[model samples]
Target: MINTRKKLITYLRKRDGIKPSLQATLVNIRCKLPDVVIFGGMVRDFGLGVRHFSSDIDMVTTASAEQIRHALAGLNPVMNKFGGFRFRENGRLFDIWSLQDTWAIREGHAQAKYLSDLCRTTFFNLDAVIFDVHALKVRARHGYDEDLQRRVLDINLEANPNPRQMAIRAVRMAIQKDLQLAPALVEYVLEQLYGTSLNLTYQSYVRQLHDHTGRTPESAFRFEPQLKIW
Candidate 1:
């Protein structure tokens, strides 16, 4: 695990990779106050050895939201509805928040009381990985490593903000990443496809897919039938 973490940090610290000031700012705040950890897409994508990962970074800490706001006051941080302080520095978006305010854990949609627990609550297995920017360590859920190895698109948690919307995301991920949809994920997508798909209009579904993934409806639909892996 340490070796994998080192690889991840090495990539992030590379000359053309993650901006040095971005990491330095987050780590410095974490050092002065309570521990701050980096997780979500940034860790997930780069941990898989993706060099052109997205620019958004997500972080959580034991510090209070107010303290975090003060720590990042220089960036002109704005608190979002999710109780996270949002700032843009070096042309990258950073979301830093108190762990107590994580929407899933706070709303009972998922459970995690510590830094390690944070990775287990994500909607997708591929995203359920974390790096403690301060501790210089990494942690992942049970199937996390294998999912990355195999490039399989699947769910880690069923109850999320929008399961129907995620069905589209699963298809987009499978197509975009060239991943196979796991049986359980196929099962969930099928249930949502035939079951609650009526909850959303066909145009809305197509629009959402395009907006969320930048893939046209034709691209998503062409890959839709592949979900029938049985």
Candidate 2:
């Protein structure tokens, strides 16, 4: 784990290299909040060396909303409905929030009381990872390291409110990372594959997302699964 953690830092530095703006923003947050840490997908990307450039990142701090607003006043952070503050740096979104207001914890899907607890609230195994920006350390739960190593997607939580988005993101990650879907994940995606009040098929929506994001490699578009109709 120690070696893997070191490798994550190494990858972030060498591959897609961290941007100066992001570095400065993190430093500023640490200086003000002290308890802030970067968590979720960014950590997963760094650990697996999957990037061509740095972009948006999610961070969590134990500070109160007023404190966070005051601390980030220079950035003019805009509060999202979920209580997260968003500000742009070099055109990249910085999603910082109080640890106490994480959607999973606030919605009673998970419980957390510290920075590390943030790792337990992700929707996918690969995303259940956190990076301690100040200490340069990594922590994770829900088979994050194992699944990331094997390049598989598995469910970390199944009771979330956005299964449709979850299913779409699962497909996108499988394409972007060349991952195989765990049975549980596959079942969930199959169940939520179609959107409500729309005639779009799963493949169509995925294609649209692929085109819009332009992040998934063209070669990875090989997911043509056969369904077993009941």
Model 2 root-mean-square deviation: 7.3
* CA displacement after TM-score superposition, residue 230 of candidate 1 (Å): 21
Per-residue C-alpha lDDT of model 1 across residues 107-184, encoded as one tens digit per residue: 887666787888767888887878888777888898677777777767787778778888877766666656666666
lDDT of each: 0.69, 0.71
Evaluate model 2: give its lDDT.
0.71
**Per-residue C-alpha lDDT of model 2 across residues 65-97, encoded as one tens digit per residue:** 788999999888999877799998656788998
Which residue pairs does candidate 1 place in steric collision?
none
Specify the highest-TM-score model's number: 2
Q: Which ten residues in a row have the lowest lDDT in candidate 2?
A: 221-230
Pairing residues by index, what is the TM-score of model 1? 0.77
For candidate 1, give the lDDT: 0.69
